[model samples]
Target: MNWRNFLAPYAQVVEELKVKLKGMRSQFEYESSHSPIEFVTARVKPVSSIKEKMKRKNIHMDNIEELQDIAGVRVVCQFVDDIYDIVDRLKSRNDFEVIEERDYINHKKESGYRSYHLIISYPVETIHGERKIIAEIQIRTLAMNFWATNEHSLNYKYEGRMPEKVRTRLKRAAEAAFKLDEEMAKVKDEIQEAQRIFKTNKESDD
Candidate 1:
């Protein structure tokens, strides 16, 4: 099968789904006033031939559609807990069907990385008909996403296997990222409380 031929049909569906998911950001924000919610971005990435090679080895490449992982959406939240809350709300939606889920936050990888991933099937009505495409949604704190971006680049540069020393360094960096997230959460709480106190004092003075 010529996989490239399939891209066009799916690309349109991907764009439509992106718009729908982007619209949800405002909804999430209105519900979670303590923090900002934004659609990180969305894209449809073609699966590299190297990925195909890895799939041949029991790694399980589910479908040609599944290969385009960036097809759907990425929701970036201010806090780690917000990521979970957003996922809970998304899972409850009738329009989405959860196909697969991986919670890397609680079960950190050996590399000490963390993020939550969801592969969901949602129906998109095209001129042809209603097609259910599987889109992968990744929810992660801003810090986690930054660390992942750096780690991905390093992995690509090292051809997927970094030297032992570099690997150790990356693991340490991941730990630092985890700590950064915790500290950020604490700071956010302090700032919120301070703002509340200021508001109360201003109202009293008035």
Candidate 2:
């Protein structure tokens, strides 16, 4: 089948999934921000080209109706614990079926990275009919995402094979980013505690 013919239907499904996920994320942010939990931002990306390449390789994208992970959503959180909390809430939704999950935090990547990924099947009713589409959800802290982005860019520039010096530099950067994440987490807790104390003092004075 031609690329256009193969992708048209899937593209529509992906767009619908993006809209739904965005709406869900907005609701989540609103509800969580009021509490001690920090709000997170969601990003959606379509992997149609990657799926097409898999087809060329004769890899049967699981559930042809739901070509695995053609659409992706990334939820970036502030703290490590928040990542798990958000994933739990998302998994609890009846509209989504978690197909697979990977926790890269506890087990860091060789490149010294961490993130959580969830491959989920989300049902969307389109003009064609009800279609279950795969959406990969990635959850990570801001620091982790920053490190990953830099490493990804460098890897792409070097076509996955970089000079030893550049590789070492990236490794150093990753370590620095890890430390930065820890420090930021500590600062965040301190600020939250101060805010609570201020609120308590104001209430007492009143």
Candidate 3:
């Protein structure tokens, strides 16, 4: 199987989703309002990782569409409220259909992972024709992103055989991250105002 050929469409989905999500942020900025999306990042899963996932899940290459995160996009926000705001916006969009949503923020995973996941069926126009592919959009606060990033690195390091003590420490860190997010939420209005003023000055200077 040609990995490059197989992954081209997933790559396109990531690129397109990044542009559209960034456009949402730009629109909010243009209107001089708080954009729920602070920043967006996206990627197509690497072939090696995909192969590992297939092996772990007993998935076949022919049924790759079952892997919802082949094309992944992350929307990071300043506040927890911003996450739900962005979710609503994504749900209302016409370009892609949201097939499912998992609200991990309210019901976090046992690993203390907290992110709102949206499974979207994205349509991409390829040279052959239009292809609809399953993709994942993850929305989370900056605090959550930081914790999750480190947790991911640790998971990679441990190779899914993390010691009980290390897992306990991670769970404690996750709670601390949530507390930070909660504290930030209390001052969210002030932060947004300061950012708005800074943006205005930057635009004037430009």
Indicate which candidate wins on lDDT.
Answer: 3
Prediction RMSDs, each to the true structure: 4.5, 4.9, 1.2
- lDDT, candidate 3, residue 104? 98
TM-scores, one per candidate: 0.79, 0.73, 0.96
lDDT tens digits, residue span 1-206, model 2: 46555455456655655666567666754554313233333333335556655666666646444445555566777777778887887788887799898998888887787899988876766667787766677888878889888887887688668888988887788788778877877787776677668767887999
Indicate the TM-score of model 2: 0.73
lDDT by residue (49-141, candidate 1, tens digit) is: 526444654345454443536365777876788888878877898886988898999999998789999988878776678877777888998
lDDT of each: 0.74, 0.69, 0.93
lDDT per residue for candidate 3 within 82-201, as digits (tens), equals 998899989998999999999999999999999999999999999999999999999999999999999999999999899999999999999999999999999989998998898889
**Model 1, residue pairs in steric clash:** none
The segments of candidate 3 whose C-alpha lies over 4 angstroms from its true place after superposition are 204-206
- The superposed Cα distance between candidate 1 and the true structure at residue 119, in angstroms, equals 1.0
lDDT of 2: 0.69
